[model samples]
Target: MVFYIIGAIILVGVIAYVAVNHIPKKLHWILSIILLATAGYLLFLINNSIMEPLRFNTEKQIRYTEVIKKLKVIRDAQVAHKTVTGDYTKSGEDLIKFIDTAEFAITQTRNVLVKQKRGLITVDIEKRVVDTIGHEPVRAMFAGKDYKNMLKIASNNNIKFIFSVDEIQKFGNLTEPVFEVKVDKKIVLTGLTDYLIRQELEAATGDEVRGEFISVGSLNEVSENGNWPPYYDKADKNLNKK
Candidate 1:
């Protein structure tokens, strides 16, 4: 809008200047036509320059929103995998299979009376005297029905998101395991226009960064946090308003 306004002001100023100079009556029509054409072209450039970034910003927000959702699903699956297997899987294929077929042990504990050496004592024990009472399918933990689709990014169907698990040392003695799920932004914004893609990458990293992936959790540290910026929350809040 500001671009349009500025272009209009410049256009009007040029026409006013041409009219005030009044070189010749015959030349007025030619000058006015040329000025109008120039103004139209300038407006086109201005509108494209301003609107392209806005369009790219919006597209990026949407893509990231979906990417974030998928990343969360991966996180949940990883957590569930860790819970049942005592370790995270590095393969995306294995993760998806686990989500589709694996079941987690469900156990319950309660206080019960026990015979002690001196007297009767109350003790907390598993409901069935076993660690697991029953099992729940991993799919039950997530709302989405299709585990395969969840493994891929929403934008570019050709590319599958990456997942990896590694061990990191803590306290210089103990080693802890961590997993990271990632999807490249280039693949996420693949179908977008060239200009929009360029704008999105520039805005995201402030440079011509390649192979930038949005991810959750960390392979280098014992953390299950995401790498997205806080502005994602703001963008989601604004979207919810609409």
Candidate 2:
């Protein structure tokens, strides 16, 4: 609508200029050129302001599709494991632990292993060094207990509290007092998983990973772009792929 209005205004101005020039025969050619240029500049402004974000959204959609594809691959692998084990049941954390072990193996060879991460609020308990880092939401083992102070007190006692991913799996309840451990080098450990868990967080959350898609995207993008592309693969042309 605005574009049409602007174009109509320019057309009116041009017609007026022509009529006045014929009557007065005094209008300069430079003034006509200036008016034409001003109209063109307005069009350029509209394109940059209105059209660029649309382009950006197109790029975002493409990147999101790729994320979903990779996530599906990871999910298929997890389903395969469950099929073999005859356990159609496992909590999100157990699946992550399984993948964590596998990720560890891949890193030993210094290979690029992609995984998805999802944030969930859970209590972590170990020997008492419970601080939550990574994408997971951290909370206190006891409802009335202050998790921060608990961790601080535990650390002072030289007790290493393990983040309670394991206990949560066993007890089948996040409400059970679980110790949170800040896994060192989360970037590294997150990618590592045992043989039992094939694809790290990808298997753990599946599409639920959608919640933290932005953060996972940020980390992966940084890693892929900040470092050289994989030796066997081409560099990603999509700037938003991370």
The TM-score values for the models, in the order shown, are: 0.71, 0.29
Q: Tell me how many clashing residue pairs each candidate has.
A: 0, 32
* Tens digits of per-residue lDDT for model 2, 53-119: 5654454334334333333323332443343343322333444444433221111122343443446
**lDDT tens digits by residue: candidate 1, 51-95:** 877787788778878878777677888898999998998887888
Clashes of 1: 0
Query: Each candidate's lDDT (Cα)?
Result: 0.74, 0.35
Candidate 1 positional error at 225, Å: 1.8
TM-score of 2: 0.29
Residue 193's lDDT in candidate 2:
28
- Model 1: lDDT to the true structure: 0.74
Give RMSD to native, each candidate. Answer: 6.4, 21.5
